[model samples]
Target: MAYISVLKLILSVYCFFTLFILCSTAPELCNFPAIFNFGDSNSDTGGFSAALFSLPPPYGQTFFHMPAGRYSDGRLIIDFIAESLNLPHLQAYLDSLESNFTHGANFATSASTIRLPNRVLPCGSGFSPFYLNVQYGQFHQFKSRADFIRTRGDIFGSLLPREEDYLRALYTFDIGQNDLGEGFFRNKTIKQVYASIPDIINQFTVDVTNIYWVGARSFWIHNTGPVGCLPYILTTFKTAGKDSAGCAKAYNEVAKYFNLKLKEAIGQLRKELPSSAFTYVDVYSVKYSLFTHPKKYGFELPLVACCGYGGKYNYNNEVTCGYTLKMKNGSEIVVGACEKPWKRVNWDGIHYTEAANKFVFNKISTGAFSDPPRPLKQSCFNPS
Candidate 1:
């Protein structure tokens, strides 16, 4: 009788332990019907290309087999995100041809800044006129216009997202890098740049608030990456102190400062908007890891552009990638991509290759780098 009682007790304990494990580890995923993305080239599907001019070939050769309006050699992190959620890739809101927005729309454009720029692209400033505020305005217009178009009951209605999806959509942001770059390009002092971060974050907060008012509840915001580690900053600021990994130390510190402020602002937003779910993704850490430990990630030439013109970092502002340059001897040469882009981190001095972006997406999607430690699929779960 005693042996039988002991056996029963052990069985009960084992069952309890198994149940606890199953309950704790079971997946708690959010069913986000759509994704409304906003930002710069980091997540731009084709906004810049549609709004301005289409990018030349070799831009999307790795994945899309042609210029797909992305700056990288293939898909961006946003593309991986959409794929993970089982949703169709978002079409640029600015794109009119061959676009379908049933799942959602992308409002990101290359060279976009959180703050308005004094000058824009093609005019030599290299910044996009569609800044953060302008993106918000576009989104506001899209919301109303899409609803209006859906009422028409035609093929266009099928292409637009369902009205209910707006409330359940995952709102993503990947801007602010260009704001810092803009300041640096203007030769602003580090202190001046530091001082400008607050206003920049405030602008971001206001747009987010406006978006919230428009029924967006789940927000997944990405902090700016390591600007100092990029080939553009490294080659431009030759005198900046280099870390052991070859990244510029001072510029990286400035980026860190911006991220710190942005995180704090997010915390405040959580308080102010109690009903919303906010996920702060530390992409800077993930991206910086590539520079610090490139070999661990199966990458080489971490700071060199894979598809840029002649230079120490294989980048040139004068002769950018895919641009045809005329030599003095009347010969024309087109700057082309390297033989292997998968083994490289930087794509064209300003963006990450598809491999690097995939690595980043894999890391951050695991929730290890999120503020609340929630996976990408579970981002809508509010801990507060």
Candidate 2:
């Protein structure tokens, strides 16, 4: 009996070792050694709040003890990507007001637009006339990212030189959601917005091509998220019906159209810049999966936000999650909190909670970041 048991134990051990080796030796998805980010609040580690101090509450209350300017409770997608790459979280360009930039930098502003800026507006304030033209001109004048790199090179020359090979570094972009949400969707029809997508995509392509010129070879681009499902839009705006099903469908269709065009654009970029490595991370698909498969992903709530109050979709952006608001009629609007805050998908109207962000990071690491033509192709690391 003892001899038979020993044989079985040895067999199990051998099988475990074999499986581990096979999994470890799987094909790589991306070959990115370092990561740099450029986008809006979705990936802004602390840029907006660093420049302006009027940011809302519960912004960075998840991972960081205090508000780190991130729109989420914890880390954003960039933070997860950096952690997956075995690198420290990429510092915000503004947050690095006193830090070194040896690893990477994030130049995403809260309300930065990829489209040309015609006028300058306060961050988070809706776009005004000439917003695109003015911002685009400013983007060009500052030589934007290049200027940032040069400044960093000048400052951190002793630590990390400019000539050092960053060709293998991954550059991730997560913008355009704000553009659609704050611009076209707020004012124009879906058809009108869809018509302008080509121009918007073309402008982005130009900007990305410029980044390639500046030594960014590997790229991970994220398409727009599901704008229709956002709490702010559903609660504030009167869509087709009660559950916001119609509004979500319409918005998602536009997003899908944009993503399709974006894919083609990336394909063109690959042909145009053969030496550069590019991959598109489908933020829309991932976010949709989270909403549709909340139970599968261990999420308890999918529709309502963990934060906010009043009604089903009435999210309180100005007040903290547990605070009470006084209406004009002298009646108090009491806001209720979710039982398990971490289990809820959304923290506020539009942003995800820390747990959701972590789950999203995991999905990206396993799905997109570990698939063919990804930016980081070696091995996937769990976000810290």
Candidate 3:
């Protein structure tokens, strides 16, 4: 009888310790070790600027106090995300000088598209050569080289990620806007652009799968924002029909269609990759809200560029935000930025101001603009 009693007591103690350990280890919020970002200008920290020419002053005036290689006057959405998660800002993969890959890397670049452009940068148009597939290739090389270098156990090892960090890392994507933009700029009709979406989405799916094959498990994919509301679009497509919010109606419809397809693809991916957690962020809705009700969000002139020259939208493609032009009287004059960039939504007619990016980040980080309604902190947890 004493032996049986002792056995029961041992079992009880074991159960108590097991429960305590489980409860203690259970995460209240996701603990992401790193972030691997892929996309276009929206998330490009300095990829394009490093590959091409360095952006001039006033580009990062609002926060960095100098040119920081970001398209905005200050920080980008990805910058805010890294700050929220207590991770260091990701350096561009293309940036060879002073780059540390310990946390993660950003493969995004300005004018990047899902599909490879017909002509690359400084050619037919200003499209980036580092498209989605190229970015994946770069990532593949990075992973392999990182492993090879870490085996040496030198100081370089400390500047690279641990093998397990890739599995726990959050993979972020904010691409595909340029695909639609490409179709439109190439003189493809609205119907033609719509027809091209399936192929665009297929490429996106393939790229995501490629990343997954490389051991990425947590995904935070942001759908493209409302391109129709951009000052560049509004200024260029002058004949397009306008919505109640003064945005291009047909262009927004195309964006909605693309978003719908992307959502569906994510749902399929969830079922296919049961071990992975995919979070679809509806940035389009949050951005559209800013345009519709600018005053509600403490913004004015939602459609105008904070820095540009000429035209009704204060944007002229011939003379961009930072260009210096020689006057007919033989005097040099810089275009310069607006006095108050924080009060405006658009920056240089193509990107958002730092203030606008922060606002969008605030809204989406709450999970209100996310599909499955999961906050960014809990993105690794799959919804039951």
- Best-fitting candidate, measured by TM-score? 1
Is 1 or 2 the stronger prediction by TM-score?
1
- List model 1 lDDT by residue over 257-347, tens digit each: 9999999999999999998899999999999999999999899989999999877899988888899989999999898999989999999
- Best-to-worst order by TM-score is 1, 3, 2
Q: What TM-score do all the candidates reach, one by one?
A: 0.95, 0.78, 0.92
lDDT of 3 by residue, 319-358 (tens): 7888887789999878789988988999999899999999
- Clash counts for all predictions: 0, 20, 0
Model 1 per-residue lDDT at 159? 87
**Model 2 regions lying over 4 Å from their true place:** 1-33, 54-56, 117-119, 127-155, 159-162, 241-247, 316-339, 368-375, 378-384
Model 1 bad stretches (over 4 Å)? 1-21, 24-27, 381-384
Weakest 10 consecutive residues of candidate 1 by summed lDDT: 375-384
Clashes of 2: 20
lDDT at residue 206 of model 1 (Cα atoms): 96
How accurate locally, in lDDT, is each candidate?
Answer: 0.93, 0.67, 0.92
lDDT tens per residue, model 2, 129-170: 222233334334423454456666455453331343356677
User: Which residue pairs show collisions in model 1?
Assistant: none
- Model 2 / residue 2 / CA error / Å: 30
Q: Note the residue pairs that clash in candidate 3.
A: none
